[model samples]
Target: MEDGGQAQRAWASNPPTAFIFLITVFAFFLPILIYFPPFPPFRRDALLETHVQVGIQHPSESGLRKSTQKHNAGRSVPVTAEGTARNNAKDGVEETPKTSTDGGRIRSLWIYPIKSCRGIELRQSRVLPTGLEFDRLYMFAQLRSPFPAPSSPSADGSGPVEHTWHFITQRQFPLLATVQVDLFVPKGEADSDKAASGAFLLVRFPWKERGLRGVLESAAAKLSRGWRAQPEKEFVLPVAFPVGSSSSRSPSPVPPGSGQESDAEEGEDVEIEDRRPRGYTHEKVTIWRDTVSALNMEAELPRELRLYLGVSNRLGLFRVDPARLREVRRCAPTPAEAGYQPVAGFQDAYPLHLLNLKSVRDFDAKIDKDKDLQELDPRRFRANIIVDNNDYSSPYDEETWKKIRFTSEPGNRKESNGSNDKKLVPSTFHVSCRTVRCKMPNVDQDSGYRHPVQPDKALRKFREVDEGAKRMGCLGMQVTPLFTNPGLPEGRKSWVEVGMSVEVLERGHHVYILQ
Candidate 1:
C-alpha cells in the first residue's frame, strides 16, 4: 500500500509523464478542433451584450458625444496667427493671398472632328458656339429601313417616296476609331480667308494592314494642294440642302426668266446672269429627334474607304446652321440667358465633356486591383478637356464643380460671379449633366478590339449612378460653354487652349455619390 501511494505521487509529479499526456490529448482532438473550434463561434448577440454593458457603465460618453466634443474642443481653443498658420500646415490646406490657389490647369485638349472617330489633340483650338471648332462636324450614317414617304404628294396624286438617313456611331461600328483627321489652316496671305477658303479637312484610315493608309494618304495629299486639284474627288463636298425640304431631290429650278419677260421688250436693259451647276446633293436626314436636310457624301467617299469599313455606309456632313440653333435639352442653368440658344454640331447632348486626370487614375487603380483587365486609357472617355490636378487628394472631385472658368493668362486671381463680371470674364462652362457611359468605351481606342469584361463591368461596380430610367456608370461631366463674348461678330468663334488656367467658379449643391 505504501509503494502504490508512492508510485501515484511520482506519476503526478513527473514532468515527462504530464507532457506526454498533454500531447496525446492534443493529437486526439486536433482534427475535431479544426472541424469545429473549441471556442464559441462569434455572435452578434454576445457582442451587442458586451457593448450594452460597456455603454451602461459609460452612459454619459458615446461615439457621437466624443466626436462632438472633439469638434468643440477645436473651436474652443483660441488660435493665434502663428498657431493658425501651424494648424493650416498640419491640415495641408494652403492659404492663398490671391482669390484661389486651386487653379487647375488644362493638361490636354482633344477634338473629335468626326463623331465617334479618333480624336485629335491640339495645343490651341478655336471654340465654336457648337463646340471646339471641327468637333463632331461629320458623322457616319446609314439609310434607315422602311424609309418614310416624302411630305409632299406627286402631281399624279401618288405619295413621294424618300430615303431617310440616321446617325451611326461606335456603338455599331468600332472600326470608326481607326479613322483619323488632318485639318490644315492656311497661313500667310490666306489667313484672312480662314473661315471661307483656307481651312480644309482631310480624313484617312490609318490602318496599315488593311492597305487603306496609302489610299487615304493619296487623297489627303491631293486635298492639301487644292480642292480644285481633284475636281472629281473634291474632299469638301459642297452641300446646298434646303432648310426644311421634305424630299431628298433638289427643287426644280424656275424656268429660265419665267418670272419676268425680257426687259428688252419693255425698252429696259436686260442683264444676263452667269449660272453655275449645283455641285452638291441634298437629302432628307434625321439625327436623333431633329430632322434636317443634309448633304449625303455617298458619292464623295472613296471606294476603298467604303470597302475598308465593310458596310454600305454613307458619311453625312452637316454644318450647324445659324438659323436653326438647337437649345440644350434636359440640363440645369438653362442657356436661354445667353441671348442665342446654345448649339451643338453633332454631339448627342452637351458640347464639351470634361474629365479629371485623378479620376482616370483612381479608376485604373480599382481595375488593376479588382479585375483582370488591361490598364484603362483616358482616350476611352474621349473628353474635350482633361484637367490635371496634382495636388487634389481625391478622385472625381470635378463632379462637385458646377461651373468652371478658363483664363488665357493665369496671374489675375478673381472669384467668378458666374456672369457679367468683367474682371472675371474669360470663358465659362457650366456643368450640364454627368456623362452616362456606354459600351463604346469597351472598344479599345487604339486597337479597336473589344474587351470581354472591362470598363463597363468595373464601372458598374464602382461608378454606377441613377440617371433617368436607367442606372448608368459615368466618368465625365458634360458641359456647355456660355457665350461670354456675345458682342463679337456673329460668325466669330471663341477659343480655348491647352495650358490655360481653369478655376472652379462654383461648387455643386449636391455631391454625386457613386453606387
Candidate 2:
C-alpha cells in the first residue's frame, strides 16, 4: 500500500497535466474558439473619442485681424474731397495751404479715377516706391508675368508664355467690372483724438484686367481709332493682383470728360459692358505686406499680386510738396481777398498755371523739394506752398509776389505757415516776378468727348505738352503747344502732330541767393 501511494505521488508531481487539460478543453469548445465576441462592438466609439480629444486640443489656423472695411453700395458714391465727407469728413479739419510746405497744415487733394467715387488720403506717398501702392495694387493681370520672348517655340511651335492668361473681359467677370481704389494708412489713436485716425483718399479707378481676357492693350486699341491688326493685338497688358470676391461693380458715376480707353469690336454697349468683372480670374490685390481687397473672384491665381506700378498701360497721378517753393504766399494776396480780377480783353493772356507735383523729376531743383515732390501723394493734393512761380501757387496777379526766405522751418514736411509761426520770411525781401499766357481747347456742345465711349477724343496734344511745361516751370514757357494747325494737312488732332516752344521772359538764376 505504501509503495502504491509513493508511485501515485510521483506521477502527480511529474505530470504534464496543464497541457493535457488545455488540449482536452480546446477540443470540446472548437466551434466557440473559431468565433469572436457576440456583444455590441464599441471599437469605433473609442477611436472617435480619441480623435475629438486631439482635435479640440489643436485647432486649424485661425485668421488674422484686418482693418474693418466700409463698403459703398451699387457704385460711384460721391466722396466729398474738401474737409467734409459722409463717412469721416468733419468741419474742423484744416484748409488747403498756399504758401509753404510747413506750418500751415493742409490735407491732400484725393482724385478718384471713377467720377464721384471716394478715395483715401495719405500724409505722403512716394513715387516709384509708392506710386503703385496707391494705383496698380488692384488690377488683374492677363499675362501671368512679364513674358519671356518666344523661347525657341514649343513642341507644336505654339510659343512660350506668348500670352499666359485665358482672360475674359469685365463681360465675363462682371464682379470686377468697376473697382474704386483708395490708400489706407493707419495712424496712432493719439493723433486722431482716439478716432481710427483713418487715412485720406488719394485716388480710385475701374479695375480693368479682371477676367484675364480684356487687356489694357486691347482696350487701348479699341478706344483709339488709331491702331489695329499687328502691334495692337500684341498690346502688352499690365501687371495686376489676384482676383478677390464676387461683388457687383460699384455703381458708376458718369465718367468725367476724362474717360477710359477700351476697344472691344464685339460692339456691345460700352456703358453697360462697364459693369462686368472677372471670376477666379485673379488673386488678392495687394502691395507688400499691405493688401487691398480687389473686386475679383479668380481662384487659381498661381501668383499673388506681385507687380505694383509696372502695370501695362494705366495712367497715374502724382503730388507735390509745399516745401519746394520760394515763400511767395506771404506776399501774394489771396484771389478771394485781393480783388484780383483777371483782365478780360486778354483772352489767353493770364490762363491759369497748373502745378504738377509729379513732373518734379523733369525739372532741375531750383530749391530743395524737387526730390521730395516724388514722395508727395499725387491724389492727396494739399496746396499749402505757394510760388512766385510764373507759378505753382494759385493763379496770381504777379504784383503781389515778393522774395522771402522760408523761416525756422521744422526742416521736414513743409507747410504754408512760413515754416511754423515764424512768418513767410525772416525779414522783408524782394523778387522779380511776371505772368505769361496759356490756353486749352474749347469743347463745343456736341463734342461727344464727354461720352464714356469717346473720352480720348477731347484730349489735345497741346494741353499735354503744356502740362509738362508746367513741371519745368520756367519764368516764361518751356514746352507749351499752340495746337493750331501750324497749317498742317492733319489738323493738330493727334498728340504727336503738335509742336511746342519755350519763350523765356526772364533769364538766369545768376542772381546770388540771399539767406
Candidate 3:
C-alpha cells in the first residue's frame, strides 16, 4: 500500500501538465516555427488594435482569428506590441485580468520591429488579431556606399575615427526615432508586390520639425513630389529622453577591414554601463541644424548614418524629439570613398531598430508600475515586446509565418469580470508563445550580446529532440492541441522528424475590443 501511494504522489508532483508546459516553452524558441495563436488577422490603416484592454468584453462572433509572427533565418517568433500582454482577452489568459475590446479612450499603442530604428507612428491602426501591419517591413541590409572619412585615422583603427561600421541596427541607435519616413506611392503604382519599384524615395525628412519646415525651401528637389503626397498624419516616433532634444539623419559608413573606425565617431558617444539602465550621449540636435545655424547657434546631424536607433532594452524608453520633429532625405547613400551612407538609401534594403530584451528586472518593473495608465507614448512601458521599443511602432512587428493558437472555449468570465453572469463564452482568441533566448549573439553586434541558456537540463533534453530546429519565443508559442502530436524518440536528432510544434496556419477576420 505504501509503495503504491508513493508512486501516485510522484506522478502527481510531476503533473502531465508540467511536461506539456516544458514542451511549449522549448518550442517557443522556434519563432518562425510558431504562428499567431488563433487571433483575428490584423492589418494597418484600420483601428482594430485599439480594442485590446482588460475589463472589456469581446463578442464570441466578433470574427477575427488570424496568424502572424513570421520565421526569420530559421525559427518562428511572435511580435510584442508591448512585451507580453496579460492575456486580458476574455476570461483570464493563464493568470491575467480579463480585458475588453474597447475603442473610446485614446491609449497609446506602439510597435518596434528588429528592436529599433524608426517606429511607424499610427494615430489609429487595426490589429490583425495577429499584430501591427507593415511593421518592421523593411530591414536595412548593408549596402555599400561612397563617403570619405569624416575623422582622422586611428592607429588601432579603434579611436574616434570616421565611422567604421557601415550597417547599424535599430537596436544600436534610437535617434533615428526623430525622422518620419513613409514609403513612396507613385501616382498609380503602389501595392505590396509593386511597392518595390525602382523609384523608392523619401521626399521629406521629418526627423525634426524644422526639417519639415524646410521642405518648402527644397520643394524642387528630386524627392519632393512624394513628400507632398503623404497624408498629414501626426505619427510621432519615440524620443527616449524624459526631457531633451532631437534630429532626423541616416547612416553611411561600413567598417571595411578588421581595423576600421565607425563614421559616426565624431560624437556618437555610447557608454552603456553594467550598473545602471542604458542611456545615450549623441548631440541633442535637430535634423535641420544647418538651416537653424544660419540664424543662430544651432546643431545639425554630423553624419548621415541615421539608419538605426540603438536603444537599450533595460531603459524602457527610446529617444525622440521633445521639441517636435521635422523630416529628412530617405535618399540612398553615395558610394565612392568607402561605404554606403544611409541617407534613406533603402531602394533595396534598410535598417531595423533592434531592441534588447536581456534586461528583465528593469523592464518588468516599468510595465508593472504603469498598468493603469494609457496616456503618453506607451508610458515608456506597457510594451508588449519591449526589445528597446522607442516611442513609436516597429516595422518588423508584422508577420504571417509563425503558427499560433487561439483558445476559444474560455470556461468562465465572471471570475475575471467580477460579474454574476456565468454564461460568458470565451471567444476563440489569443496566442501562447515563449520568447526564445537563443544560444547565439544578435546578428548585428560584433561582441557582448549572448542569449541565455535554459535553466533546466531536462527541458534542454526534450528541446534537443527538436535540435537543428529554429528556436522562437522571440515570443514563446503555445497551443492547446486539437490533437497532440505523436510521440518522438528521446534523442537530439528527434527535431528533424518531430513535426508537431507547428500546426494550423490560417487567416481570420479581426475586430477591436476597446472599453
Candidate 4:
C-alpha cells in the first residue's frame, strides 16, 4: 500500500515521459500549424473575402460555387428565370409584381481616381471602352510593415503576412475612404500646351498628432459638433494617363482662328518639360486573380500619411503600366453571354458599376426592423453610376436586364424652318454579370468605421440571388461599353451624362462568373 502511494506521488510529480515529450513537440510546432494549417483553411470565394496574399489563387471550379451562407435564417428565392423576384408582400413589405419598360434616368455619375478612395461626382463623364475616364487610374499599396516584427500582421490581424506593394482597399482598411483625390487640369483646351504642363492630382488626408493649436482647435470642433474639420494635410501629384501619351505635352493642331499671334504657329510644337518623377520602378501587383505590372511613383509621400494608415512601411502609390493592359473578359456561363473583352486599370473587376436607386431604398427598408441600425448610405456601395428607378415598381428589376441603352432626347431647339434636330447617337452597355458583394459595403464611407451588423446582415436575408456565387449576396450589376471600334482614335464617342434616359434593351437570366 505504501509502494502504491509512492508510485501515485511520483506519477503526479512527473507525468508520463511520453506525455511530456508530446507536449514539448506541440509547443514547438504550434505556430507552424497556425501559420500553415495542415488541413485546408476556411477560405471564401477569391473575391468574396479579404486575401492576405498579394494575389489570390484561383480555386477549382467546384470549390468556387460552394455555399458560404453565413446567415441562413431568412427565406432565399433562387433566381431561376428572367424577372424572378421575391414576394415580400407576405412579410408586410409592399412589392410590385410587374416590371417596368419605360426605363429610368441616370441620377449621378462618379469617378474614383484612386481605387477604393473618395470618389468625385461628375455631371458628365466621357466613357472609354475600359470605363469612365480617370476612374481607378491609380492605387495606393502598402510597401512595408509598421511593426518592428519581421512580417507585418494581416489587415484583420489574422496572422503574420509579407505584403510588398499589395493592393489596399476599404475591405482591408476602411480609413482609405478618408483619402480624397482631385484632378486639376489647367484651364485651357485639352490639347493645349498649358493644360498638359499644369495638370496634377490633388490628394488630401488627415494626419495624426497636430501641434498644440491644432489639437485645441480639433477638440473644440469635436465638442461643438456643429462644423466639420478640414483635412490636416494635402499633396499634389503629376497626372500621366491615356496609357503611353504624355500629359498635354504631345503636339496637337491648334484650333482654327484661336486669335493666337500668328497662323504659322498653329502647327508649331511647344516643348513642355516632363514633370513626372524620373527612374520609375516597375513591379507586378495583384488585383484579385490578375497580376498587373504597375509603375511605382518615385515621389516620396509624407511619413505622417503613411502612419495615419496604420503602417510604418512607406505607402507606395502605383499607376497602371501603359505597356501592359489588363484585359477584362466577361464572367458568364457561355460565350454568347460573354460580352466584349475590354481593358481596365486598377479597378477590381469590370470597368463600370451601375446601381438602381430603388434597390438601395429597398435595402434600407429591409433593415428598418433593426432599430439600432441607421439608414444605409448609398455611398457605401461605391457604384460608378447611380440610376433613379422611381419609374420601376419592383426593386432589383435590374437583375433581369441583360443590356441597357443610353440616349439623350433633343429639346425643342430646331434648324431653320422648324425641322427637328438630328437625333443624338445612342450608347449601349452590355450587362456583364451581377455584382457579388462582400463586407466592403459595411464600412461607413463618411466615418470610415465598419458597422457591426448592417446592410451586410440584411443583404444575406434577401439579396443572395446569384447561382454562381450562391453564398454571396448581389446588389449591383457590372457593365461594359459596347463599342464597335474601341481601339480607333475616333471610336470614343459614348458619353454617359446625368439625366440621360436609360432604357432596358434586353432582358434575360444572369449567372455570375468568378474570374
Q: Which one wins on lDDT?
A: 4
Candidate 3 lowest-lDDT run of ten: 491-500
Summarize candidate 2's per-residue lDDT along 1-515 as a digit string, tens digits.
99999988977886687568788998877545334322222222222321211101111210000000111122222212421221122223222223443111111212222221223232222211111122222234343434445455653577654333322222222222123333222323212211111222222222235453446434343333234511111111111211122332222211111133345353233442334342332223322222322333323222211222223432221111111111223213233432231111101122112222312212212222332222222221111122222222222112222322222234432422222242222321122222221111111111101112111121222122222234211222111112223244232111110001111121212111111
lDDT of 4 by residue, 1-515 (tens): 99999987887788687588889999998767545544322212211221111111222211111211211234242223333343121122222322233456676678888898888776556677668767887888876443556443765677866555678888878888888776655433332324433345567787535587567545443433334753255555555542233332333222112222232453464432232223556777777788788877636366667777775556787877545778877652232333344767887788889987767766777884454457676778888888765432366877766678876655412211123122255677877788988888888876688777687887887888777787788899898777645556467446666666777776666778788
Please report the TM-score between candidate 4 and the true structure. 0.66
Residue 107 of model 3 has an lDDT of 20
Q: Give the candidate order by descending lDDT.
A: 4, 1, 3, 2
CA lDDT of each candidate? 0.56, 0.24, 0.25, 0.62
Better of 2 and 4 by TM-score: 4
Question: After superposition, which runs of candidate 1 have C-alpha atoms over 4 Å from their true positions?
Answer: 1-103, 147-163, 189-196, 206-279, 313-322, 368-373, 410-425, 466-469, 487-493, 509-515
| Per-candidate alpha-carbon RMSD to the true structure | 27.7, 28.7, 28.7, 21.6
Residues 1-515, model 3: lDDT tens digits: 99999987887798887789888987776443234322222111111222111111222311010000111133323335542221212222132122221101112223333233433333222222113323332223222222654344544557654321122342344343433443322233222222222112121232222476445333322132244442221221111222222342322121112122344455474322222222433322212122111011111121223322332221211222213322211211123211212211111122111122222222232331222321112212113222221222222221111222221123422222323222122112122222232322221121222213222221233322211234322322211111121122111010000001112233222121111
- What TM-score quantifies how close candidate 1 is to the native fold? 0.60
| lDDT (Cα) of model 2 | 0.24
Candidate 3: lDDT of 212?
Answer: 62
> If both were scored by lDDT, which would come out higher, candidate 1 or candidate 4?
4
Candidate 3: misplaced stretches above 4 Å? 1-115, 121-167, 187-192, 198-433, 436-515
- List, in order, the clash count of every candidate structure: 0, 53, 157, 1
**Native-structure RMSD, model 1:** 27.7
Tens-digit lDDT track of model 1 for 378-491 = 888888887764353245666656667777553433221122233233567777667778788787886677676678888877787434415667788888877655546553
